[model samples]
Target: MAKLELIRNFCIIAHIDHGKSTLADRLLELTGTVAKRDLQEQLLDGMDLERERGITIKSHPVRMEYAAGDGNTYELNLIDTPGHVDFAYEVSRSLGACEGALLLIDATQGVQAQTVANVNLAFKQNLKVIPVINKIDLPAANLELCYEQMEEVLALPREEALCVSGKTGEGVKELLEAVVSRIPHPELLDIPGTAALIFDSNYDTYRGVVNYVRVKNGTFRRGTRIRLFNNGIESEVKEVGFFSPEMRAADELTAGSVGYLLPNLKSPSDTKMGDTITDVKDPCPEPLPGFKEVRPMVFSGIYPIDTADYEQLKASMGKLQLNDAAFLYQAETSAALGFGFRCGFLGLLHMEIIQERLRREYNCDIIATYPSVIYNVYMKSGEMIPVDNPVFLPDPSGIERIEEPIINCHIMIPSEYIGDVMNLVMSKRGICTNTVSVDARHVIITAEIPMHEILIDFHDKLKSMTRGYGSMDYEPAGYRADKLVKLDILVNGEPVDAFSSIVHTDMAYGRGRQLAERLKDVIPPQMFQIAIQAAVGGKVIARESIRAMRKDVLAKCYGGDITRKRKLLEKQKEGKKRMKQIGQVNIPQEAFVAVLKATETNS
Candidate 1:
């Protein structure tokens, strides 16, 4: 076993595209964890979606052996974490397993909203933070501005900041040495039995569930019997190993070490992330303070395109839930969509990633409904009901008031684009709470907005208004009473539950008009006219109609009397009117997908 004093556990935290994965690749190369010939960009980003989008989704952990300038070899456990605001929960869980973090900043874009948010999370965990300015090799790199922002916005010391180029591998070796010298070693609590914290877990088709953990005390061996502290379920350890950027077998994992363990469990749901694993016979007196339960902010319904794939979709979601702790789901049936699941996610990006993964990794073709946020509905009797789906909302007469989720949003952008961003925010029903000048050219704006308003296109609009120079981060700020109403879409006088949404009273008319128009373009014309109407409390707000396909009834009346032609047309009209009364509109899968895309861009 390695000595405790020679071990350093740290993770890299930064904003999106700020080079967290790139810096991790350089560290792996310098430590010789992976050979130089085998090195690649974004080695830690294992998902195709992540690589294609140029972002990190999951937190990756690996162990390295670094020979430092002090003449002692050190064992470094590095957890590369995602930088997006949607994945902040992943960053928080990763910080729990490490003693320190590398706070990376881009030299060109010094202080971002997520950069400040990550620093706060690290401080909450009491982890030591080492500030590193990345992308120093860029032509627009401004080191002085970076230092100023670090001091003014982040309250971090300027002298402690280290300048490094993650792309060119400049000063990486020195950064590693600093990691060994500056970052404190992990402190092992004096516990009686083995207690390791499971930070992450994934399912392997051949081996069941594989858990990635950080050993807090004692040793975990191949044949040791273990129990989960949260549920007290016992199992035998099948194997123990470390990630040398890939799984490498080890005889045992000792104190203060980060590694993976295979337990004799068959289902992915059996093991939970942040659960404490300890020896079955001699467990610790108290369970470790695991992570707080993550609350999903956005809710949507996911249905299989082919109804026969329902079971497969369920299994796929189970595996995905094991991988993503922030995702939540339950079985829900819709009159328009049939058997499906209502899934909750952290944000729109997180929701999109999950849908893509279901298609690519699990080969499950799915359709997602328009995203919505949970609302608190208080009735006249003082009964409060939480509603995530509009179909479950009570009658208008019984509802005393509706409270929507609010979020405190922080946006950082160039000073010149402040007017455009402010206008965009005000249009989305947000109130600018404060504005602070970070530097002469940059500004930070804080606002309070309804979570549902931002669930669709707020981030995209912010980026466009600021010319891709703006970044945002947000957190839930509880719920407030509002004039909210549920808008239902009726096709051929039948309300389709899948197209219903809870919207603000002021926006109900415009939003309903947009959705009704979009639906008209996608829903195919039937033999009878289909009236697409958006209604709130049985009052229609917007309406559109698809003209019925016409049949040439005058083809057999050539050279006949005008009365003969008119009688034929009248008979055809009667048939059409009767068909319109009895015919059912079959809304295709493409209509749902088209409306979803339109809402994401225009909402």
Candidate 2:
């Protein structure tokens, strides 16, 4: 085990695409953690979805040994965190395991919205903040502007900022030296019992639950009887190891060190993230302060494409829950979609990523319903209920009021696009509360927007209006009473629960019309005409009809009597009427996919 005094625990925090993963690659290279031939870009981002999208979805931890200029070998425990707002919970959990944070700022794009948001989170954790300006090798690098913004916007000292290029490894050695000298060592607790805080975890088919922990007070070794403080589940330690970017077995993990623990966990849910692990025989007097529970803001239903895969989908979701703490799900059944889970997420992107992972990692074919936000429904009988799915909404006559979630959104963009962005916000029923000029060219607009309104296309629209120069960060701003109504979609006069949503009263007509039109284009035509309608409180607000496919019955009677032709046509009509009475509209899988895409873009 390494000495406690010679260890430094820190993490890299920044905006998305600000070079957090690239910088991690350089650090791993300089420290010689991975061999040169095996090194690749984004060595920490092991997921295929992360690599394909060039974004970090999870926080990765690795231990590195660096021989410093001070003539001593120092052990650096670095946690690389995701930068997107949806993954802020991941960053917060990572910060709980570290003593300092390197606030990375791109020299070309200085002081974006997420940059400020991350800095605030670091400050809240009482972590040592080291400002590092990255991507200095780019042609568009503007060091002067970056320094000014760091001083003015972030309120960070300009003299302490270090400049480096993660791509070319310029000034990386100095940066490492600074990390060792500037960041303080983890405070060693004098408590007796063994305790370690689980910052993250994942599931393995063979090994079961693998927990990534930071040892707090005592040493943990193999074959020790450990118990989780939160769940009171006991298991014998099967293995103890360090992540050299990959798990390497170690004899034991000592105090002030970060490593992994493999315990005999029965199920993934038994090992909760942020739970304290302690020796069962000599338990710690009190558990450490764990992270706050993460509440998912957006909710949707995930159903298996084939009903036989329901059990497999449940197993896959349990494993996924072990990996992602922000995702929540509970079993629910829908008339149209059959058995499924109503999953909750932090945002739209989080929901999308989870679905993709379910499809790719677990090989589960799933279909997701339209996303919705949690709403407060007050009944006339003086009872209140929180509704995330339209199917659970109570009858309109019995409901007294409905309150929708609101968010405080901060958007940073170029000054020239302020007018366009403000207009867009107003169109979405959002009000711009304040605007501040960060520098001569950039402006930060603060607005209060309903959570459901901005769930799908708000970010995309902001980027387009600003020409890809805008960034946004948001937080929940409580809920407010609103004129909300549940909108239902019907196919051939049958309500489809998967397509139902709770929408504001003013936008109900237009949204319903758009959905009806999109569904009309996707649902295949049958022998009889199919009517698609959008209804609010049993009143049809919008309607569309798919014409039936006609058969050429007259081809055999070229010049026959007109009465015979009329009889043939009348017979065909009667057949169609009978089919319509007994026919069931087979809504294809593609129809759901097409309608989902339409709803996202139209919102």
Candidate 3:
């Protein structure tokens, strides 16, 4: 086994588009872990979508060999994590595997919202946070302003922080040295039983489920019998390997090391991130501390456009779930859209990513309804229901008082656009908790708002208001009392369960009118007129109509007696009854998706 003192475990944390992946590529090149000829942009980002979007969706861990100035060669395991708020849980899981973290801030952007949020998490975990400012090669880079932001906002030592450029090989050598000298090696225990933290896991057709773990005590070797501490599921370790940037078979992963293990796991549900893995014969006495389960914060209904694709969609979702254990979904049916799945996601971005993958990866055509947040419904019948799907909203009479999930949102923007940003947030039921200046031109605002409001294009609007100079981060802050009402949509007098949503009473009328108008545009004209209405319970709040196809039936008649007029009127009434009974409104697939865009009140 390698000497524990020669090992350094850490992860790189930064905001989205802050060059974290580029820095990882540079580090790999400098360390010679991967040949220089093989290096490419975002080498660690394995997902095709990640590369296309220029973002890291999943956390990638790699082991590197570095020769420090002290003339001693050290081994470093660096976990590259996604920087978006939607993947914060991935960040947390990655941090739990390491003893230190590289807290990177963009020199041009300084310390934005997520920058401070990452530092606070490092502080919470007691990780050795090595502060660094990147993109110093850019002409607009404000190195001095970055120092001040780190000092004032992050409360970091400005003089000690390193400045580096991922674009050009500058200051990276010193940063590597700092990591080895400053970051402590993992203090692993030598006990009779084995223990490891499964920070992340994914599935393979041949290998079943492959888990990436950090061994805290003992060793994990091929042929060793392992069990998950929480679930008590047991399997024989088929393989033990470390990332040589690619999975290379390692004889064993000793204590204080991170690697992957194939243990003949049957299914993804059999394993979980943050669960303790131990030897089956000699299980540990206790699991690790502070293992919070992944809870989905945003939910939406994903219905297949064609009813026959329901089974294929279900199989696709199951395969996707084997890779992502955090994504929750259940089979559901809608009268308007037919068979579908009600999926729960960590955030709006997470929801969108899942929806995109369903269409792109599985080739399944789907209609995703408006995203919703979980709600707690208390009823007079002494039943409390958790409503994640909009179709299952409890009746208004039974609800004692509706409670909505709230969140504490942090927004950082340029001082010049502070008024615009504040106005935008306040209009979305935001209560400003605090506002402070980060630097001469930057300001940070803290607000408490309904989480549901944020799911509906809040980030998009925030960027539009701040001219793309703003960044945001937020977390769920318990539930609170709210005046929420369920708004239902009816097409041709037939209620569409897919379009129902529980919205704030004050904004329901506006949202209803918008939905009606949008649907009127999308629902094609039929032989007979189709009336679309949005109602709150039994009262109609808004209405729109798709006019019937007109024909010149009266062109043939120049004049008529009362008998002829009466006969024509009777014939028109009979046709109206038949149309009402049999006519079907050809609702465009775009109509369901249009409702989500219509509900955005961020402006």
- Residue 168, model 1, lDDT: 94
> On residues 231-294, what C-alpha lDDT tens digit does candidate 1 reach at each position?
7789999999999989988999998999999999987777777889998776888778855666
Q: TM-score per candidate, in order?
A: 0.94, 0.93, 0.96
- Residue-level lDDT of model 3, residues 504-524, one tens digit each, is 999999988888888888777
Model 1: lDDT to the true structure: 0.91
TM-score of 1: 0.94
Give candidate 2's error at residue 563 in angstroms: 10
lDDT of each: 0.91, 0.91, 0.87
Candidate 3 lDDT (Cα, 0 to 1): 0.87
Candidates 1 and 3 compared: the better one by TM-score is: 3
- Candidate 3 lDDT at 184 equals 98
Screening candidate 3 with a backbone cut-off below 3 angstroms (N, C-alpha, C), the clashing residue pairs are none
Model 2: per-residue Cα lDDT at residue 155: 90
User: What value does the lDDT take at residue 489 in candidate 3?
Assistant: 92
- Per-residue lDDT tens digits of candidate 2, residues 1-603? 778889999999999999999999999999999999999999999999999988999888999999999999999999999999998877887888899999999999998999999999999888999999999999999999899899888899999899999999999999999999999899876777888988888888789889999998888999999998886788999999999999999999998899999999856777776788999888998878855667899999999988899999999998898777678999999887789999999888799899999999999999888889989999999999999999889999999999999999999998999999999889889999999999888899999999888988989999988999999999889999999999999999999998999998999999899989999999999989999999999999999999999999998888868999999999999999999999999898778877876776666
